[model samples]
Target: MAGLDWQGWLTIGVVLATLALLLWERFSPDKVLIGATVVLAGSGILGVRQALAGFWNPGVLTVAVLFVLVAALKSTGAIRWIGDWVLGRPRGEFAAQARLVAITSPLSAFVNNTPIVAMLTSAIEHWSRRSGVAPSKLLLPMNYATILGGMCTLVGTSTNLIVAGLVHQQPGMPALRMFDPLGVGAVAAVAGGIYLLTVGRWLLPLRRSALQQATETREYVVEMLVEDAGAMAGMTIGQAGLRGLAGSYLVELVRNGELHAAVSPEEALRGGDRLVFVGATDAVRELRRLSGLRPATEQLFKIDDAGGRRTLVEVVLSAYSPAIGKTLVEATFRSRYNAAVIAVARHGTRLHGKLGDVVLQVGDTLLMETDAKFLRRYGNRAEFLVSNEIDGAARVDRPRALVALGVVAAMIVANTVLGVDILLSAVAAAALVLLAGCVHVAELRRSLDLRLIVVIACSFALGAALDRSGVAALVAAHLMGWAGSDPFWTLVLVYVAAVAFTELVTNNAAAVLMFPIAVSAATQLGVQPMPFVIAIMMGASAGFITPIGYQTNLMVYGPGGYRFSDYVRVGLPLSLVVGVSVLLAIPRLWPF
Candidate 1:
């Protein structure tokens, strides 16, 4: 250990930095990880060749490839095939929704959750509107179901892979066994399902929109200055605290003659960049005056074209969303998919007027309109959250259903059965399915969540540090001492803390920081780590208190006209219910 080279110390330091940024919420995890990689590459911690290894990290690639498979399901309308399987015999609004949750919750075990939400958002909206049940009734469950699904498989979420990867690295440490946490996750999911059916409904926000324009309306547009500002000058919208302006938002920061790459929450704002803020008409106007900014575009609001063949709406992207951190240009959103972006809102910043140059990122709200054909054609191209609730039947493409099912199935089989890493299988399946004409090559680009890539890549670097820096091990040791030999207590400490942390930062970030602690705890107890890990996976999804917790919740917060308390009112109970469920099931499935 004393003889470890500069590369070892550098690698360890980089990983420690990754954990610090995420755990402390000091800086953007993506930014921290990317910077760490460059630094580590320079020090030869992972070697010049291995430094880029993160780019090829199976977890990162699996997430990206899964995007394409999900897109194919959405594009081909194969997801629709499964709709009947879940929603066919709805007992009532509550029961039907519960059933939907039950089915989707399980499927998420095999795949990621963003596409599941994208595939369902419209359908749920349409179902609620048609049945006269509030969409608030279904959405919380949708988010919960997807989250629970993520707990079932290692490849389901990047968090799981991070845990598996790190644990495997420790000498004598166990690599994750298939279905190790399945029992615990299933129990948690079940308890959560019941809780959602019961107390969860009371906690959800009620929001529905009949008019497309009213729903899609860009909040407000204001102009901000980048002149001589410290952080703002070098910062992007995300980095400039502009995205933090939740209630009111800034659209874009205009610099001399050029729009920035994308309005990332982590992006640095540069001096002389004219910032555009979009929020409530009143808030937008007021913030402009406060910030000494002006409007870059005239009044723009959404128009309801749902009744007609054409429509306009806004979409908020989830962290896992394929649309994270890519512009319409790279995804060819307009030409290939045939939709136009009239404006974009990254919380406080509003991207309007010059749409073509704007790069997109997760959590950025997009305002656009197109005909039914255009939506139908391009809907599967990008994984965007419904910033504005959409009104229509969740469209289906029967021709693409087989492709979707086969590709997804092949991926799962490749990972679990064939001993291939899930990511490799997913990439291969996506490529083969697309080349085989199941999905278009163009669709692949549209489905990637590039920002997520950045986040995952960075998280991996952090995972390295958690192990090397002795931080994760230390934390685990502490928790084990406190929780003692009680498996229940251990689960409580790991799972409960995971839920709390995720609500504060991103889930991927939360897992990276907490995983080492869980590993350490397992070591202290001299018991297997599976049960404790199940706790983290379930806990990360427990962010139900505020719109800020999960991107899904944030996407719905304003759109639902939900107050911060609304999440607490509903999400708290759901969190507990899920928590209890994990306790009951994990012991059985992965029995410590």
Candidate 2:
């Protein structure tokens, strides 16, 4: 063999560097991509002028804007409102929770899943308190639904958008439509939903939560007098329906003098008995109004507001934090942080805690209740991961929400009816939303994850380097040499490789890396390049292996209380099924 060119050697070095970084998990994939770009630019494999390609990639811009859109919906409390409806509806406990996943999954199809989970976690915790359902019962469904919903459209997930953009870049490639994945993806997603509803539920590792749902929502040690005519005077605890309080629960009952914290739900409640209810002040007010009761004048027990401005915060537990492997009781978040963790969501499992001793895991989301400024004060500490709350502070103008909704709708309609350039329409719509004051310029940056931006930038530069170095063609020729005479099997293998690579790296990176190979393979096989290019695009969009493979997966991971294997258990099989589905569809839909 002849000596390799400088570009070839540089390409080999780049690939080796990537492999070493990934093997060690030494840095975020974003860092890896950026580093690759810098290396290629320095080596002259990527033209200095081409280095900016990723910043302008339509796929990157689409994902960024979609993040902002989802953020806007999240800030509006729309997702939480949906979660509230799902959790509060009168239905069988499991059935109601299942309905929550069903609703959330489809909503994810239209919007991004991460912000959806951030908004819904709070609502589920609220339901856990009022309905006395284990938070563990609801969080898994939330995660599954988001993944399922991501299958609805090309823009539903960043991976899909990246793949679509890749196909658009190919000289002979066909342009993908908005609902390009609707047929196969929807079928797989719905099937995935069914899997979660039945088999996957059984496979989840159920951890008993630390927070026990008391008879009361959250008991405030308030004193109550036994009145002859009061509703509690003649009734047993079971008959009082203490759990039905809108915002609280009655956990302890005090009579004339004796205190009881272990009262059963079925215990009798009698009037004139000094009782203690673990409830918010407003709930107490409603209880008093409905029961016609008087407040105790003498201090009976310390009554703090039910979780004092209960807020849902997503906290990333850091490695150096005191909470790392310890339970809440051990961490003393209540005493130390002055916060009550109602639920802990990690991966696909939800662990409930009673402000007691539930050990924490890295990346676990503590569904907490505290003063608004309390957690914000400790946000920079090492103990907790960065937190994001769906802030509904901006006074939402109904007209603004309506107009924003209208713009997004118009863009979608235009794209579908007239085949308008989606990126152009969407960019215009985003501008309109900004001009209408729906979103400020300063807030836009936070909406999109910078990880995605870096990944795109790196992938674009890498693609250019591959084109310049001719390394992609060399690899593709070798791969094609193994195909022999049958074209169908080669195409299937190509798709499979793309999907596999996507599972290990960012979708744009997968596309950029694989597209050059796909094009080269088509040339060697003497076949239409469209089939191979489309196969790569389809495969790159598939992210049904690990939660780390996709941003949407990570979004739901901490909130779902899922272990790494939960996705492998459910997603691996679905991925295999979808792989075959794509293999069958691509040939028929776009014909070689």
Off by over 4 Å in 2: 1-4, 82-90, 93-105, 128-142, 208-312, 317-362, 366-370, 373-399, 482-485, 529-534
Per-residue error at 300 for model 1, in Å? Answer: 17
- Per-residue lDDT tens digits for candidate 2, residues 1-592, read 1445978878878976775675455465667878888888888777777876777777777876665565445444444455555556645556865787678767776666655665566566555556766555666567667765775676666666776776676566677788776665665566667766776666555533323322133344345565677666667655665544555444356665655543555666666666554434455565566463577777444321333333444565643356666766466465576554544555545543232445666566665544555533664343443454423232345666666667767777877788887687677777777777766654565454666577676677777677668887777766766766356777876888787776776556777788777777777777877677657655776676786565455544564455688668766766676566667766676566
Per-residue lDDT, model 1, residue 163, is 62
The models' CA-based lDDT, in order, is 0.61, 0.62
Task: Work out how many backbone clashes candidate 2 has.
Answer: 47
Candidate 1 residue-wise lDDT, 95-178, digit = tens? 877787878888878766666665566566556656767656676677777777777778666677766655555578566754
Q: What lDDT does candidate 2 reach at residue 356? A: 42
